[model samples]
Target: MMTEQRVELAVTKSELGARLQTSESQVAELKRENEAQAVDLSAMEDRSNSTELQLQEHKTVMEELKSTVEGLKGHIAERPKVAFSAALTDAGSVGPFNTDITLIYTKVITNIGNHYSPATGIFTAPMRGVYYFTFICHNYGANIRFGSLLYKNGERIVSMTDWQTSTDHDDNGSNAAVLQLEVGIRSTCVSHLTARSMMTVIITAPSAASCSSPCEQKTLQHLQRLPALPHVSRRPCSTFSGFLLFPM
Candidate 1:
């Protein structure tokens, strides 16, 4: 009876030891799972922080771009629109004057800023800016030559001369210049006349009294000969055009 009791006690002790080993193994496995979960959570937090930083950076860039665009729009809106185009006459001939004469482009086609005056044959700059000017001279029939001089504040800037040849009856000459002008500076086109006197001196407004000494009576007589051209044709015989390229 004693031996049987001893064997049973031994079996009970072995079972308890195995149960302890199993419990320890489960505890180690749980610890490893908890460590892995903690690592995953840390990685997720890092990614979220990185995404938030990138979003902030993109938002800041967008704001700066928007501000720049708005500023450019405002600048464009404030810039003044300055441009003008005019024609010398619809009538056939203007020259054969005794002396040089300022050619008045009386027929205004487009005068956006109204800086060019038809009354005086002059363009007055409204502001300090870089300006572009162009002129066209046309002559047809006979042994006629057309010459024009562009002047800025009484100083010559450019000149154009066209002559009708035996083969070519019609002739056209053009000149263009980019000029830096000051506020209130005057620009004019003057016709250089020869002995024949067929081209310029064709002033009707403010009279011929404003002309040089030799031109008054001759201009008046010519005015009497030629009638006023109220209606002009589609194509212009001569043209003077200018525009403000940019403000200084």
Candidate 2:
């Protein structure tokens, strides 16, 4: 009986030892899993921070672009207004085509609030397209030939002559002329009419035309003021005005 008891005790002790070994292996595996989870968490945090920084940079760039656009709008809104006027001489004959009776006077009259000086008033052409030009001349009863000429860059583009006036006593004749020009060109009108005569000229962009590369469209608005002139006893004379329009 004592030997049997000893064998039973030894077997029980061996079983207990094996069970403890198994529990220790399980605990080691759980510790390794926890360590792996910690590494994964650290990696995820790093990526999140990088993404946040990138988003902030993009947001800042967007804000700067918005500010630039607003500043450009304000500058355009503050542009100055352009205005002009002219007067005729008293008691003079207009012309027989190259006659000295035609007198021309030009003046710049800007608004008090938004005034532009002549030095800065001249605008550069914004495109390389075609432009349309027109001139009109009105003659009172001077019986003299009346005409108007358009000049571009100091060169004549078109000249109009009165077809109704045949003699020096002819009255109430009017003339008009039209021409086409290239963009980036500067021009003016010359009036060859008697005293108390009036003339008007206009230059505008051509439809279906495109601007040159790296150029932008400019804004143009008409503002005019007529200057008073002395009364002439010859014929009732007409008045004059001028205008220019930008990119087509």
Best by TM-score: 1
Worst 10 residues of 2 by lDDT: 212-221
What does candidate 2's lDDT look like per residue over 61-156, in tens digits?
889999988998896675433233332333443332221222332223322322212343222333333333333334433323334544444344
Query: For candidate 1, lDDT tens digit of each residue in 186-233?
Result: 666655445543343221122111110111111211233332212233
Please give the distance, in angstroms, between residue 157's alpha carbon in candidate 2 and its true position after superposition: 4.9
Q: Supply the global lDDT for candidate 2.
A: 0.38
After TM-score superposition, the amount by which residue 39's alpha carbon in candidate 2 deviates from its true location, in angstroms, is 1.3
Decoy 1 TM-score against native: 0.68
lDDT of each: 0.62, 0.38
Task: Give residue 241's error in model 2 in angstroms.
Answer: 11
